[model samples]
Target chain A: MEFTLEDISDDEISRRRDLYEPLTASVRELVDAVIRTEVDDDSVREAHRLVQAAVETLRAEQIDGSYGVRFSADLQGMPWGNAVIGLRNAIAPPVQTVRDSDGRVTADFTLGAAYEGPSDCVHGGICAMVLDHVLGDAGSADDVPCYTGTISLRFLRPTPLGSLHAEAVIVERDGRKKIVQGSLSDAQGQTVTAEGVFIVPKNWDGPMPRKARRPGEA
Target chain B: MEFTLEDISDDEISRRRDLYEPLTASVRELVDAVIRTEVDDDSVREAHRLVQAAVETLRAEQIDGSYGVRFSADLQGMPWGNAVIGLRNAIAPPVQTVRDSDGRVTADFTLGAAYEGPSDCVHGGICAMVLDHVLGDAGSADDVPCYTGTISLRFLRPTPLGSLHAEAVIVERDGRKKIVQGSLSDAQGQTVTAEGVFIVPKNWDGPMPRKARRPGEA
Candidate 1:
């Protein structure tokens, strides 16, 4: 089916983006709380029960399905429970992704002690996940809607727990494919790099706002 | 430094590949039992305890480190504990990997009920991990120790859980960088396709035979 972002209606997407934005900070705090809470076991048990009850309340409002991609009329897209981009998910490492008008995407995140894997170092797999999400999104400019085909990581240096920066840029493009690379670094700028190909499905229905005005086009 | 697969003493890395070969069939039986056992809870509980005991006994006799990489004096190499190549690891599916002298790598694995994630399909992450390991090995061929820098995958179809085949080849290479593409298929053919970049450390050692050589040989 011929698809374009304009068909969805721009205000719808923007309203949804605006709807989730405030939850960004709230979700970040929730993740930190989940990770670092040092309350006694009984308190933990009580908290778990309360959380489970809250979840059931929300579950009452949902359908039987997995989280899938969703878009807005103006093409302001959002992935509700996105492992990385979902603004309301506490399990996510709490990343704020921004893509510039020039099509470069960057994310800034501060990982805490909760993200630790190897005693003092952050888990390598988690690092790979972050890179995968950031670079995949950056490569797509959040338009192509790419999935992580493969992610490889080199631990040049141990990632210390604390604030870290992750960034991605489209290095080049192949027909229907995007070459994107990304990195994770400390406050000092010591960096570990990753590069991958982001592909739009041979068949995808996504945004296209720049075509010559179609008949009756806005 | 210069290195070759022959650098490591035979006794240091050699183990009869059969040590874990039988476990493949045994694990399959265990999985079948899990699926078919019509026993009461007490019987199931007993079975679970027995399985745990067997696992602990095996774990006690093993090494403490994550399986990194190993090569033999005959120039035959293997990273045996790798979730994909690890013969004895029940957690790893029954996959065998072989790299030809010319540097191409092929992986063959059989998925069973235990590997399923969505009712009847192989877990998406497991498929990606297997492909990552295969592509990582291909890029690291010629002894260049490239860590997975980035991998992106496209899931074309639900990889049916059963006997599967994957082949990977280096599609592009530059100084210290290799791009590889490979695919997964059942008896019929291609199901999911993957491509990734394996990157060599900037200044450590060089490619394969050379990386296998001992330090200071240069």
Candidate 2:
């Protein structure tokens, strides 16, 4: 629940890279199954009853009320649930963030039936969410954290499901603001385009951004 | 189900407006209740079930499946969803598209509990979707259809729920490619900002974009 720089050593980062990265992938699949499972109604009732028992067991083992962040020597971060950076989360898809040298940002992921809104195509709301986060990543940079001052999107085409990649970069910056550019591409690399702006607080100081807030900063 | 300059007489627009004005007010109340109600779960379920039945009854009386579009003699156009000009949609948010005299494009709306993502903030994706649509309107120019060729966004801060205003204007244009800038604002103004390249498709010749395709067209 606390941290010293000693906790984020490069060696710890290396260890999580080895251990947690694969954990994230398998857990993501488990999440997918929970949503798509075709178990009978009676079976669902039984499962929930059983899960309730496990929940009680976990409650008995608690030192804290929340799932606190956990870290190894590698500084690999794992914030589970619907967290943008989760460790062992299943509901989350194959999405992972990547940083480019110019502060551009991208996420690569596969979307499935769980994301459907139309009979086909990814749900418009889901597409917007992915774009918002990826573009937010580009605008935040590693230095000055940016919040969404304003954002806009246009659904020019139907975005099909399955593997997709999104990319964004800073098109312009004015003082505390950034104009980020990006797109979602299917595996074939046909892009579904997007662009947005990000701004920091008028002053440099505020509650720290997500990466800075580390209850997991062991 | 079709309307043209010749088929629409002044009396029809006036008559239709009289019928819909109060439904608009009632729908607003329903949305407000969805947000503020603190009824017990059983009551909530009962109310929702009753509302669904009432809506189904009302839906059956309507002869047509689509809402229509119209322009008053004053050229005050109400696209009414099916229009290239869109207004309140139950499936979509109550996004009201407004065009100013200077050709700037904007939308004014309030987002509530249904849009929440973070504990207290609006969902990042919803912010991005509104911004993208607002920016697209600028590129569309109220005439030439623009598609979401690409959009980029940057989130500077968490957008709190309740009232939000977003605007977009053309930044530049070259042939079929147009660049527009946009932002989302609160009472304090300007929460998330964005820009996009909304395009005039190179190969298509149509009144609206490929999607929103009219029932008979395909």
Candidate 3:
């Protein structure tokens, strides 16, 4: 379900991006409050009333369509609605990534109490989500579109809810298919490790070859 | 992490449950709008301001702690803040499940555009999350606590965004260890299949066994 970048001007992209980030931040605060608040029933009910009214007011003015994925020519291949990278997604952590010349991608972020699964630890599913996104993105960094075909993860230990790091690297390649290995770690040490198989769709015309290496030569 | 049901009365649980459901619904609606709204930049900014003000107002009337997991005595094992089942989590779909007398579990739910990953299909990580949760829950239905130790998943095809179904069954059990197999499908057919090893923590005192089973026993 790939979408081509729209022809929106850079100015519009900046405008929309600026407008959405603050809104997302505010909503994120609300999410934290919703999960952590210990107000009494009376206060909770009062807050709910005010929140509902605010939502209704906003709904009354909305246009009748979803904010479809948008990408500018300058920022090609970036989907503003991406669940992992999209700033507009409140569930997405403030993940930042750096890709080294060796084709490894490393990310740093924090998982708050909102993502808790086992008591004070991060949710196992969220760990899978982060690894899947980082590994898939790493595979596609070769300028070839690749989709995840299979992923297996081992949870070595419960990932704590705080600063975390993840790294993904392509371990092998076979024509349009790639195998990637990744790991997520916390302050204590490695918490989860993953391996995934990614494949480029048959119809995709990938970028012209930079080096004509054989399938097993890379 | 696990939490024992507090000694709260049924009336308090019912009171709090009734209050939270509508609030969650309102916030869910707001999430949909925040992702889809198409108003002009000025309007978007105005909405942001109002939303922020409302959040601040609620925040000012703060409670000291988080809304910890709570369950009534009648619903002893239920976790209200569960990532898969929590009504207060906007990111969670409305997943409903039924456990039969034989201990098999089946679930039905819809994945909206919010969960999209590759193109228009549901996110691969989201698929893993749902399977982990459903399978883990299925393994725990025998009045024994089980946690997901490892999960392996194969994506047969892209899972489209719409109604989906999942089922899980315990294939084998040995002492406190269990092997569970699960599948997720859409209208077209099976899209993903999974196998997981669930472990009851070492200190757990599981229910008195009807029969002692070996690793290969059904």
Q: Candidate 3, residues B95-203: lDDT per residue as tens digits?
A: 6666766878888888765676656678788888888877876787676767788889999998888889998889999877899999999988899999999999898
Error of 1 at A182 (Å): 12
Q: Write the per-residue lDDT of candidate 2 for residues B88-178, one digit (tens) a residue.
A: 2232355666677677877777765445445446667767657755676677664566566667666666787777888989888888888
- Per-residue lDDT tens digits for candidate 1, residues B21-84, read 4433354344333333334444444444444433333433333333333456655544343334
Question: Please, what are the lDDT tens digits per residue for candidate 2 over residues A121-199?
Answer: 5655467777776777677665676666655565656777677888888889888878877787786664456666677
| Whole-model Cα lDDT of every candidate shown, in order | 0.53, 0.53, 0.70
Over 4 Å off, model 3: A61-68, A208-218, B61-68, B73-78, B208-218
lDDT tens digits, residues A1-218, model 1? 12223355656555544544343333333323333333444443443343333233333333233333344454444444443444433334556676777777777777654354333445444566577666766766745655444444555666766788888888887777778878889887745677776666776776644322111111
Local error of candidate 2 at residue B166 (angstroms): 1.5
Docking outcome class, model 3: acceptable
- At residue B102, candidate 1 shows an lDDT of 78
**Interface RMSD score of candidate 2:** 14.5
Tens-digit per-residue lDDT, A75-150, candidate 3: 4334545566666666566465667778788898887656656666777888888888888767866767678888
- Candidates, ranked, DockQ: 3, 2, 1
- The whole-model C-alpha lDDT of candidate 2 against the native structure comes to 0.53
Sort candidate 1 into its docking category: incorrect
